[model samples]
Target: MKALMTLALVSTMAAGLAGCVVAPNSGSIYTSRQAQNEQTVRIATVESVREVRIDKGNSGTGALTGAALGGLAGSTVGGGNGSVAAGILGAVAGGLAGDNVEANMKRHAGVEITVRLDSGELRAITQDADELFRPGERVRLLSDGRKTRVTH
Candidate 1:
């Protein structure tokens, strides 16, 4: 009776422990800047940029799978006295292995952009200029034989 009770308790605890591992978390942020100046006059250029990402370790699914397999293997080993201890230890080891596998599988994506401008002289003529730039809008430059302008 005592042995059966012990075995039942061990099995229940092992099953419940399978879901103990947590999944990893990750995130990213982006930033950019632009400035305009008067033509034919000396202009100084300055720029700043930064990017950040956060990540956490551990994967829940892999941990549970590993724990179940490890517990089963441990239960198979040792006959009466040692089986329970072996099962508990195996579950813990399997959980950590599963977490490592999950962490390795997790991926974090990032992006970077750089622009360089050359120093040149330009003529400032009075003409109609348009400043129709807005956030979340795509801008492209097109060049024909001689002139380049923003595409619509």
Candidate 2:
């Protein structure tokens, strides 16, 4: 019971963290502060759009979750000293399964947008592919000294 709750909580946290990848959110607008801090802005024409899958590297949350759930399940397998051994074994096996599951689930579908700047320089930005962008569309490239984003 306790193990299941822990597993649920950890799973939720892991998913939330994985979903927090810094992609240019659809229709995300820059705040006034962000606009003031931008290093550069440019107008660009989309040259190409390619679908991609972005991997969110494992942070070990899944393995821990699996271990907890597995240990709980294993604890019921046998009696006395044997139960302890089963729980330990279950934890190890569960951890590996959890890690793999987390890795696969953490990947995000994204897009690589290739654009040509007015000055003829070419750049490509990869972001979560939630919104469809077409080639030849005019977009504003927003940068805040570190990351860059393109928007209509």
Candidate 3:
């Protein structure tokens, strides 16, 4: 009964932790800092597009949450010293699993768009694959001098 409850708690915590995942860096999405800022816009022709994987990286929340939950669950395994050992083992294992889970969840599909500016310069911008681009397509490039994105 206790172990079952702990399992339920662990599931709940993991699910909750997933909510903290970062938002996609899609062309349509903007950070608060990026909002209300003027960006330079230029016209460009798409030269090529490639599928990519965007890894947002981990924030350690998943590992920490998993460790705590795993420790609590594992500690219920045995009595005395055995329980302590189990908790430690569970923590290490859970942390690794959680980290992997978080990383996999944070990984998103992206695109590498190579474009030719009207000025005849070539540029490639990688971003979340929220929109599609194809060769010979005319697109608008928006930049804040630091970040750039391509859009239809």
My TM-score estimates for the predictions, one after another, are 0.38, 0.75, 0.84
lDDT of 1 by residue, 69-143 (tens): 676667768878698888888888887886676665553422121111234322111111232323233333232
What is the alpha-carbon lDDT of model 2 when measured against the actual structure? 0.77
Best-fitting candidate, scored by lDDT: 3
Of 1 and 2, the candidate ahead on TM-score is: 2
Q: Better model by TM-score, 2 or 3?
A: 3
- Model 3 earns a TM-score of 0.84
Please report how far candidate 3 places residue 40 from its true position, in Å: 0.7
Which of 2 and 3 is ahead in lDDT?
3
Task: Report the Cα lDDT for residue 141, model 2.
Answer: 86
Q: Rate the local accuracy (lDDT) of all candidates.
A: 0.44, 0.77, 0.85
Q: Which residue segments of model 3 deviate by more than 4 Å? A: 1-19
Against the true structure, what is every candidate's RMSD?
Answer: 16.0, 4.5, 4.0
The per-residue C-alpha lDDT of model 2 at residue 63 equals: 80
In candidate 3, what are the lDDT values of residues 16-44, reduced to their tens digit? 47655686678889988889999999999
